[model samples]
Target chain A: MNKKGIIFIVFLILLVLHQDFWNWDNANLVFGFMPVGLFYHACYSLIAALFWGIVMKVAWPTELEEWAEADDSREGG
Target chain B: MSTVIVIAIYLGLLLALALFSKTLFRGTSKDYFVASHSIGPFMLLMSVFGTTMTAFALVGSTGKAFERGIGTYGLMASSSGLIHAACFLLIGIKIWAIGKRYGYVTQIQYFRARFETKAFGYLLFPILVLLVIPYLLIGIIGAGKTIAGVTGAKITPKGTIPGVFPEWTDNGAIPPWFTGLVISAVVLTYIFAGGSRAAAWANTFQTLVFMVMGILAFYLISDRLGGLGAAIEQAKESHKVRTLSSGGEVGTSQLTFLSYMFIPLSVGMFPHLFQHWLTAKSAKSFKLTVVAHPICIAIVWVPCVLIGVWATGIFPSGIPSGAILAKTVGVLVKDPIIVGLVTAGILAAIMSSLDSQFLCLGTMFTNDIVLHNSKKEYTDKQILSMARGFIIAIVIVTYIAALLLYERSVFDLAIWCFSGFAALTPLILAALYWKRATKVGAYSCVIAVFISWITFFTMSGFGGEYFVFGGIVPAAIMWFIGAGAMIIGSLMSRPPSEKTLAKFF
Candidate 1:
């Protein structure tokens, strides 16, 4: 699959994992302090942040920036 | 007194910064409205993140966690991290490119051009203003709540009236409305003088202040409560202030939580956010905002939710959720200087968003309605005066509205505001991606969003935790109503002009 396709799938996976029904009743603690549910979501926030960073690096639309820059240069000269 | 002194100093510094920004103001409407499109990546990141993290994220989140328990973090913060970034990646960058290309300053400008209808903008502008008014209310109300929590008199004054403030507020606090006025004045002073440029500069400074203070408050309170592990254990053991069930199920309202996923869609339509996007130096500037937003949310929210949860153990007798974070710091970290700084930090979180919202309202009024209607070039002085005058007018209106909503929960009030805009996302989404989206279709969506949102708001007595029939969130129904109306309205009516389609696509 192309990078765009992969990005889509990963985003979908992240969305699904965001609804953590499995952890709902677990009532466990993580790292001795945080509630298991809160801990899970904290990690989820980080992972989502990381995923978007990769998406920015890999899948960002350079066409938009290129078009804008090209227009600026054309106007300048 | 020391606490008051500290807050006063912070406000003074902000005023000075706004004056400094005014020194750099180029004498042009474009420069005033979009800062001549010169904001770079780091400032963009700080400004956007700062604007998004209002009192709703800090005091509001902690207060909510105190009432709702641990699941609050997962419900809003985790979901917002991914979804907000998704919005920046998908919608924000697109809008920025268009704004950069076309010199559009308001969303209505883009809509007017995209749909080939001035009438559509006419229908859309008031709805955007209406939705944003409540958003302004959230920050104003939140600032009041935080300050009142810190400064409400310890003992009630004599004969203050039963069931009316002072009597009912003896548990400790001042009025949120009073603080809202003072803070709004400070915000108005800066934005009035400096426009969008000053708002950006202040947001960068204020965002830094609030995030640092949030971490500091977290450490001091947790250390006071015998550290994080002990605090969590004590909260679990107490069970009085906690909303957790015996099984510790995060929440049984699975459907309500699911409905909240739609709330972050509001970001896609926030006029303030649109105005900020227009300030980006490049489409590439969005890369920082997209990547760093979720991490920023985690840094602010996880600590807040945990601190709120710890409050369950600390204030077992019960405390108002609005003041949970403030009260916790007051009791745990007792130095007035520290207290005042923390209060300022919370206000930083609240005020950062207000400046942009205020500026956007002014921008939309001047760019979309005033200038567009007049159809003549206005001088720089005229434009600046118009923007500033309209901003002050709206601030007065929002201040009054915030007073009436003094009793509402900041989180729930914000959700109601967000839900309206969230429902309107289909309008922008279809405008950007759907070639078949006609002006009629956009109108259908906006009108449907306004009507359904009003029905629900009125039913809930103007805004609180409300559900549609069958125990589902109102946003779920409103969102589908909008989508369905838009598709049907478009299919039945004429398509947009091919020229327009070619332009947008």
Candidate 2:
């Protein structure tokens, strides 16, 4: 499934469980006792951390060759 | 008999672990201070969480909740947790990135390098030392109090020297000096032996002990209150569910919310928390730790809040609102074994936070300020020795401060420490995110925060006796002014060199 589809399913599940569209006080319904607010906060932090990790993983310089090239460019400048 | 033996074994195991880690201590500067920057995710998670939890969470947070009702949870838990997560997301990643790039071991190094001003570093270093020392004293004193209270050991009253160490008392008793001495000895011994690495490893064990105890306390307390449903019912009956309740007029709630927001944001900028971020093995480790932190928070804090609420219903009279819950727990739990375990758990929370704070403050003073400005080059061994020396000095000074100043609440000490960082964080964030931010602006921002926080804190002390407004109002105003000065100063001044901008951005 697409990302949008996954998000939609999660939202629907939360809505059905909570029975209160977006109200914090009434949104205590994930599993038996845990609240949606709690889950939301946890998931938000995890996703943000994961996204940043991906960025750093992809962008960080690799290998001695790359370091030498970057150093040469700096010297030229 | 089994319970007492279990408790004894646990303490022995902790001491053994401290000793075992000591063998790994090569006395090199890096190994002593930051574990040679080889800490893993599990070590990182435990150390950071353990240090942040503190004795304040165990005693002060619950006591405050009992006094102020459910709003205290919002102030201390949900808002604080969310802001901490945000800090990791926004500023923590950047701190790790820059720290690695510059090979910066301490937060002060970052400040010194970024501003390109050793003078600025000199000024900022003392502020950290001054604000953080009182907090260390609170940690030391809190542990002492918990040890005495739990062990049922006799204590001398404040300012009184007993003829000898008195026997255990069942009823009301005096405070203990021996408690302080014992706690100090344990902390100083390991920290002196192994430095930051020892503290970090011990913190991992302590964090586990604290989490289990907190969970157990919740279960026991909830059971005593009949169940979770019954506890909520009692809390509601006691009028403890008022999250938006105001102590005074209309603006009080708004002011309280603003203070909560600002205070939590300051957590990221705290010197010790910064040290934790800088020591991560990889950016990936840092990210994982941040993501996992909320689970730790939930486990640690939710139980404390529940216990606070339960205490409200169980003990409605006799005790004052501020210390009602703690006093109630003292009365209800007559089992010596359980009480001892509870007390140790509380001390674990306090010591875990205190040792981390002491190490961070010492490193900043020794490594960042003193060593940076010295003309003579020193080896890593020399630097490590200086760092350990500073830790001892900080502990001695803070102990003296605690003895001299006797009436400040732990919460007050905590917030005062936070105000210093709260004033500095905005400018730090701007410098990281905004390419146009200049050195001139950064310097002015520091100056503005320094002058404003000091002035407002002083004025509030004088004004609190008569003025209608809370001190937080003036503090909020000062933070904004400082932030504004930084932005405006940058706009008017020469932009930073392209190379400098590229290094950070």
Candidate 3:
């Protein structure tokens, strides 16, 4: 599979794993402050950010690049 | 009094920003409606971020976390960080290219062109208006509740503020109607003066204020509760499950927990977002929004949700969920200036979203309905005037509705509104990505949404954990039916024109 296809699969995996409600064994605190479940999601958010940034770099369409250049010219950029 | 003064000053600053943008405004309807499609990456990031972070994120999430626990972050914020960016990359940039190419300014305008049917535009206009009114109410009601909570005056032992103005409010907060009017007026002045350009500029400023102040409120409130560790312990003692489920235990049923995920998808169909997307200077402007948006969501939402959870332990007897944030600030943060600043920050989040929404609705009215149907050609000045006039009318109607229906929890009302929009997401996805998606399919999707939305809304008694098949949320049911209708109806009907398909694909 191509890199874009791999990124899509990774996103799917992340989505599936995000349903962590059944992780009841994690009723512990992470730092004496954060709940295990809450801490898990906080980590998930950062990972989500990193993965989406990669998707943008890998999957951004060439057509959109041409479109942006076209618009730039129209705006006298 | 200090809170009211601080909020007033914030409004003044917003209006000043609007006036400043007006000086820079080119005298054209293009600048008014879509900011002449000149917004840059950073400004686009701020505007889109501001427009999405509604009162729901601050007041509603905090209130919900107090009730549900930390799972509130997982249920919405964590997924939102991913889903929102995905939508921007997949949907936003594509539609923006189409819109910029076609000179379309509203979602309805794009649909009307893509489907080659004017009837669909008429059908969509009212539904969009109806959905947006509830959204407007979210901000208006939240502002009212926040202001009332902070400035309603302290309750004496008799449950009344011992003042001559005893009849002013039942809770001794500023009356909801008065608060609604003031908020409506402030948002209206900015939007009216500078249009979308003003809104974009003002939102960038308000977004910064609220984000900074949200962190401050979180830190101060946590410190007041004897640090974050003590706050968690207090919560675990008083409300063991205060992390983030729906009123469920930490082990929220897998199905029920998964359904909340559908709510974040509503952004895919948000008309205001469509208008904001069109304001991009180029497709490149979207990169910042897609990359930085998740982090921004984390910054704003984590603190609000944590504060709400902490409040559960601190106010053990229970506080109204809507008033949790304001009450925490009012009670725990003794410094009057700090209270005012924090309240202003909360209001900034609420109002930032409102201005964009108000401007988008106005743009739709003028572009999709008024101009699309007009037999005579209207001048640029006339078009601008119509959009502005319609916005004032909408602000009045929404303000009155807010005063009448300000009694529900902000969290519940916002969910019902999001559900209605979420059910419509599949239709937009098909419109953008599927060449076979027919006009009939879009119609069926709309019908499915209205039917399922009304049935579930009525069954749920307006709002609350109304599930189907023993676990799925009402929103999930509506979404499935809507998606099914879109796919089936498209297959059964004639495909969209070769012309339309070629244009979009």
Best by lDDT: 1
Q: For this target, which candidate reaches the highest DockQ against the unseen true structure? A: 1
lDDT of candidate model 2 versus the reference? 0.62
Better candidate by DockQ, 1 or 2 = 1
Q: lDDT score, residue B281, model 2?
A: 69
Error of 2 at B399 (Å): 2.0
DockQ for each numbered candidate: 0.46, 0.10, 0.42
State which candidate, 1 or 3, has the greater DockQ.
1
Using all chains and alpha carbons, the TM-scores for the candidates as numbered come to 0.91, 0.81, 0.93
Task: Give a tens-digit lDDT track for model 3, residues B93-211.
Answer: 98888777767788887787677788998888888888887789888987877776677657645575432135676545677788788889988998888888888999899999999
Better of 2 and 3 by lDDT: 3
lDDT of 3: 0.81
Off by over 4 Å in 2: A1-77, B1-12, B151-175, B236-240, B243-255, B317-325, B407-410, B462-475
- Model 3 segments more than 4 A misplaced: A68-77, B156-173, B237-251, B408-411
The top-ranked prediction according to TM-score is: 3
TM-score of chain A of each: 0.81, 0.43, 0.74
